[model samples]
Target chain A: MTERVYAGRPRPGNNFELYSWFFMRISGLLLILLVIGHMVIMHIINNVDVIDYDFVAARWASIGWRAYDWLLLFLALLHGANGVRVVIDDYVRRKGWKVFTVAVLYTFTFILLILGSLVIITFEPIGMGS
Target chain B: MYRGGEGQLSFILHRITGVGILVFLFGHVADTFLVGFGPDLYNHAMAIYRLPVIRVLEVLLAAAVLYHALNGLRIIIIDFWPAASRYQRAMFYAVGVVFLALFIPAAITMIRPLFH
Candidate 1:
């Protein structure tokens, strides 16, 4: 008789990895919608040619668009960061190199997340009319 | 090199596209953040995006995003429904069909401006 391996549900003990795995799928489902919509509006419908400072200013002038962008920024950064972290864990074997790369990854992800959020939150519609 | 089947191919493509998009995202956020520097600097950066080469790259990026998104859905299905693995090969083809369907039109739209 062939042996049956225990490849069913994840066993208890590591809640963090379990949550991270769940986050990837959930965030991914949302991203397919969020990012595809973003592309259609920014790249297809509008095209880069039409997008300029004034265009952005006008868009951000509305709180709705700001909120939409802020959500996208937040989710995409976390999703991408976690995805890369998984990749690093899989391939980078050497202890020192792995630690260094992961450190850099976290550092950049943190900076970009903060920087993007600040831009969205603190944007002023300068010369865009109140 | 395991040299497996469709599953292997999908897994490899997922990694490649995910990394590519992440790298692009960092640059994109930095560029968009330039808006705070005022219009002159922002528009100057926007001009680079308008260049023909970057436009072509933009289409490639769209393809990457599309593939990653579709394949991601496939992964989810297989994860939630173990029965789905039996048909994963067919679903992989389905992902391809949907990718082409959506990507071709979007690619055309993005590239159309280059001729103008």
Candidate 2:
């Protein structure tokens, strides 16, 4: 068995690690529902070939679909980013490399989140018809 | 470093699934962005995803997500509810049961389209 390692000195109040750990669980549970629903709808029930511009546009035309997808995007990204951070903390022993890797991860995650949010939130299905 | 213990196995699988989902996110975002280009482009991209290889990959992805989500709940209970920590092994088994219960049906749904 891989022995659990506690790497850093314990921090004081407003425990970020505790919050993040909790967030992972909450977001993960939500994601299972959202992502699985999405996969079922897109790949199983509807089929990917049927999910064209109009299909997407029609789906997004409803606020419900937009909200569902937005929530899915937000939770999945945050959960995945935090999970990767924990993985980095666990394996990357060197301080400098750890910082560098984490920095890159944060930057990449931030950009993706921003771009994804923009696409989902600002989507205009009517524009696609033109 | 993993010795094939139940705990270690779950731990490793969680990381693998986490990474797998992240990778899929990249492609998903890119594909979704194709909507901005027009229906033809978006439909074309969606069409490519219908290929046999991608369908097979979807089954594996479903399994990974199921295990990760179920085991993740177990980890949460262990962390927050002190008493649950004592029965961690049992919880792990429970996670497996729930995972299979969900995943088997989902896998069937995902693969059934391929044969039709």
Best by TM-score: 1
Summarize candidate 2's per-residue lDDT along B48-80 as a digit string, tens digits: 778999888978887887787777777766655
Docking class of 1: medium
Q: If you score just chain A, what TM-score does every candidate get?
A: 0.88, 0.84
DockQ of each: 0.52, 0.41
DockQ computed for model 1 against the true two-chain complex using alpha carbons: 0.52
Cα lDDT, all candidates: 0.86, 0.77
In model 1, the Cα lDDT at residue B62 comes to 97
Candidate 1 structure quality by residue, lDDT tens digits, A16-122? 98888888889999999999999999998898988999999999989999999988998899999998998998899999999999999999999999999889999
Instruction: Output the lDDT of residue B6, model 1.
Output: 77
Q: What is every candidate's alpha-carbon RMSD to the true fold?
A: 2.9, 4.0
Best by DockQ: 1
| Candidate 1, pairs of clashing residues | none
lDDT string, candidate 2, A1-130, tens digits: 5333211112214688877766776787788789879877876687765667788888988999889988988898888889889889989999999999999889877887887888888877655546
Off by over 4 Å in 2: A1-14, A126-130, B1-4
